[model samples]
Target: MICKHRRYLMYISQNYSYAILRPIQKYILSQGGEVCWFLEGDEVDSSYLLTQETKLKTVKEVVDWKPDAVFVPGNTVPRFIPGVKVAVFHGFDSGKRSSKRGHFNIRGCFDLYCTQGPATTKPFQYLATKYGYFDVVETGWPTLDPLFEDNASNPYVDDNDKRPVILMCSTFSQSLSCAPTLFNKVKELSEKGRWRWLVQFHPKMPLEIVEKYKSLQNDNLQFIETDNVLPLLQMADVMLCDTSSVLIMFLLLGKPVVSFRNQSPSSYLIDVVDPSKIEGSIEKALTKPLEIESAINDYSKQVHPYQDGKSSARVVVATNELIENGLTNKRRKPLNLIRNFKLRKALKYWGC
Candidate 1:
């Protein structure tokens, strides 16, 4: 039987994911649950602001913690650990093409999935039916909680400005990378001083590309290379992205977004094939942002309907239910036997 008193919840904190998991951590603590971090490294990234006292340095330490739930923001959770391994996704499921369907692949490492919304939840539910092991809970992403709560403030913007702010974010995938393609045009646009530009890219983006953008800095252009993109999203009047989950979050605000060479373009996206068309699309989007309000509203509902800022709370509840009820069937793992063997070998080699 599950413990009835205070519950212990641990999260596996990747170097780049602390920001994405912070909201769920905050919600768990507020509800009187014990929360701690499982640091894969000897030290947590200094940017996470977590004290050394709160981290479990190894997989053995995590198992010893006797956690009731293990929350993971990224795709995988360590196997053979006690507790309901919960996958709280790192970002929106943009449905971009990747090695294994990008954000759509179910790695089978999780016992329960606290999904972003219907767009993802529905598919996982079908998977749940097929697998007959895990459970899916339609909890809006905890990362977006602050945006809907109106508690998020933009430090980047600093003051109320007359110039319209434009945020340009792109995915790191080489197949869909737009930064290299649009940098020159964007630099020209920023030079015109018609709009304020904020350029943020995926953390995995190559350093050379990041350096190239950094070299073109001007009074109107600011290049931010931080893990947190929500604050930038809040401040921007218009957003330009391609095949990145950040665009979906931008659409949550019902703003216009232009995509370059989107493989599977959606009705809500302002699609343009050529980099030269970037300026015209941005102009059109900014001049009449409300023109596509209806489509944005529809997309937002499918992605995440709850704007009440209580998604983290819902996630906590769902986690508790899974732990208390317990899985009657054995938890599932990735179907590929070779991959599972390799994972086991790696785990043993690391002595985790």
Candidate 2:
């Protein structure tokens, strides 16, 4: 008889996973579970950045394949496994005190909830706790597995580089606040010798936004967007990011990250949560973001708490446990919708 423990479905509908997901998904399958890709075909195709007809067509063909347990990128969708559905908060949620984002409400419907690592358990717990009633679990997010598998020598520096290299990542929308904040950080740091700034815009952001930065013409500045240029993250010593969840992978590299307390889609006030200061905070951090050496020494003790980097393994284990418990409980039933069909249904009804 087939082993019941070997049941999982890993789903990512966005382009963020094409490179990173392949190995992790393979590893999940190797561990006696199933992992697959199901792309959502971006909601809008204004530019042809998403046009890989061959690859898109391939994913569309296999979209219906299912598993006993499912994993989705965020609170956006629940991968409908025959037995369960799950929503994963795969990064440091930017739900600061000022901006209360209820995007995670989708978690109420999922059978399980997962986060990046132990460093995140408390912050995420707060989100679930605030609501008073919600079903949430703390399986470490799987995206960090690559760090464990990396046999490379330690690359993190003890002090800021002579010319600290900064990577600024902007989300598709609502980046106006983030851009100025990040630019201020970059401009402040660039005066130091050889300081380089590489700004990567989200694929869906406006071209005018990209053009504004490009015109700066600082010898140390370069602006790029959702291209095949994956090396930028690897080269960045510090990553300044908006609330985009993709920052998890950058942090996994042990690089320091400065997050902008993103404002509401309509609100005009810009607030910095973690640092609680404006450009001056960037001044202090560019000089000592995460206190490079201290963050390294106390990483296991304070921040990560569970820094084994086997987060993917934990996700698989927890998901399996959830499936087992769900099988025992009569109230919990599997989420039985197909991948694309869920998106279509959401668009037709919820219009998101």
Candidate 3:
């Protein structure tokens, strides 16, 4: 059984975590639970905290608050915090790196991992069996809850001018990024006015590249910079991307994606190596061939099968269940002294 008025902490290290965790925050608040924001690193902007939202400024405050659970969207969380540490994840597995370095990297920081779907759940379940330290729960992803909601508004709806809206996004990894390679081609297509274009980049995207795209904004193209990309994802008809996890979110919407040099090119994506073929690929995706559509549906189900917009609720329930059952049967969490020390030094929390 879950507590009715539980206290939760939103441990934020990166700005994008705001979009990832806010849906969960709303669900917590609606359940008569209290949520506090703990802004840890410089990547997070405190100004994003709303007036109604409470912000815990110091590690001492977080300790004193004694949250029932600390919801972490980033990779690691301070073990010193007085709560069950939960890993909600920041994004999908974009196959940008090896399993050891990327999504499946278990840092021994979390007690519960609320995975998106089977694609991640199966691997995490294997790790749970091997480690016996944490629990894996397929509660979908809170960030995607709004995507499936009924009342989500599309601000770009009126601007499409009957043209197929193409959202262009890329990863920040220098080796994997297609922004620089596809810039000239994207600019040329945007100028032709054949389709509407909306371009959003990773926050870590180089300043020069962001500026170049910003300068290209016109009647045909618009460059958006926001902590939340859900609106842009919903507004666009088709997405043109690289290996960015945002493409996975777009695919979950049952939309077709055209990628440039994706790390793992599958049937679901219309991936092209040559920049010249991007336009043709986008045209093909717009047509939505039966085979590609079927593949996208199959892939989406594996990545995130939930489309009810209730993932946040499931996450809350999963945390409660873990707390109620306790971790008595599991083995001790590895003493990750180095990572813990780094977290302690970063948060300046030396408490035992």
Candidate 4:
């Protein structure tokens, strides 16, 4: 049971999502709130960067803790939990219409949403208006707080390596992915040794594609697969992307980005629609990364304006308000009962 003076907040981490939610966990502790973790996989244990006292391994342990609020970075939260479930979204709302995005379905699982900014809040607000379920709070993305902080540094960047570092990232979709399209071009470019290269991809990328890139790993080029890309964003001199939202987040650093077939290319992006032009674009981005700083700053304001590293604090406060108000704030029924029922069943099959 939650104490009258100090509330308890439970968070679930699935591999890399631990990176996104750790800041909120720290903030909750600072605010005199007790925190616990609900690990997504059996392989996860207390020894994995957390103490046994703070990590609850089983569903029964989570139930006994009786949290005042629960935060989920992924889409679904368990069916019947003690606390209010808050959907701390996993990725950017890139406006991509994919089956994975849950595009229009309000799953009725989350009591509240901690949105990134105005761009992300609009659609959720419209859903709240229509279904009268869930609250949308613009708390920025807590994971990004360190990026905007004065002391945040990337330990990976080597000053001795004179070559410009080029970072490549891609989404995992045929329609929007640049992975297949730019593979040969990137391999050819990396071979030249004109630049140091880093490759990161969406965790959902197909195994075949992953192996294809793994074969190309070499001395000047490295492949990274981690939940946290913020440090990578800090270290790289220039970024090459397709439609992934990380490109939008990278712009916050005021660095240059080259996009291949970005659906809605921003004025700040160095857009290269043709795969043939990627090599040339990377050279240009490396030459003058900050030339479009003014435009990138304007774009950053639209996504997340605050640089004070307090987004996690705002999310905690908003979540606590919902805890105090109780379930009266969330809609009991989903907008589409049949669809939500199916989704819930699928979630059960996955042990979510």
Q: Which digits, one per residue and each the tens of the lDDT, describe model 4 over residues 1-352? A: 2223554545554555777888887887766677777776443333545653377666667777778788888766665556878887777766566533454357767788888877768877887777776888889988888887654456667768988889999999889999998899889988988889999998778878888888889978898877678888888889999888788778888888999999778778888888889888887877765557778888778777877899988888888777766544445645455655564464343232
Assess candidate 2 and give its lDDT: 0.52
Tens-digit lDDT track of model 2 for 1-352:
2223454544555554444344345556566555444455463232423342223233333334445655666455533224465565434444422323553443344665665445556655675555433345565555544444543443332255456677778765553347754554455555443556777776666777677777764666767654332466667776777666445456545655666775422111122554336445445555654355354445433323445656566666666666655522334333434644675565343321
Mind giving the per-residue lDDT tens digits that candidate 1 earns over 1-352? 2233544555644555677677877877776677767654432464565663276665677677778888887766666566778888878877676535667677777788888878888888888887777888898888888876554446885565579899999988888889999988998998999989999998778999999999878889999978678788888888988988889999998888988888778778888998889888888888755648788999899999989988888888888877777764455555555655675565453443
> Where is the poorest 10-residue window by lDDT in model 1?
1-10
Clashing pairs in 4: none
Better model by TM-score: candidate 1 vs candidate 2: 1
Per-model lDDT: 0.78, 0.52, 0.90, 0.76
TM-score of 3: 0.97
Deviation of model 1 at 21, angstroms: 1.3
Using alpha carbons, what is the TM-score of model 2? 0.63
Best by TM-score: 3
Tens digit of per-residue lDDT, candidate 3, span 49-132: 888989999999999999999999988888788899999998999999999999999998999999999999999999999889
The backbone clash count of each candidate, in order, is 0, 2, 0, 0
Candidate 4 has what TM-score?
0.86
Ten consecutive residues with minimal summed lDDT in candidate 4?
343-352
How far is each candidate from the true structure, as Cα RMSD in Å? 3.0, 7.3, 1.3, 3.7
| Cα-based TM-score, every candidate | 0.90, 0.63, 0.97, 0.86
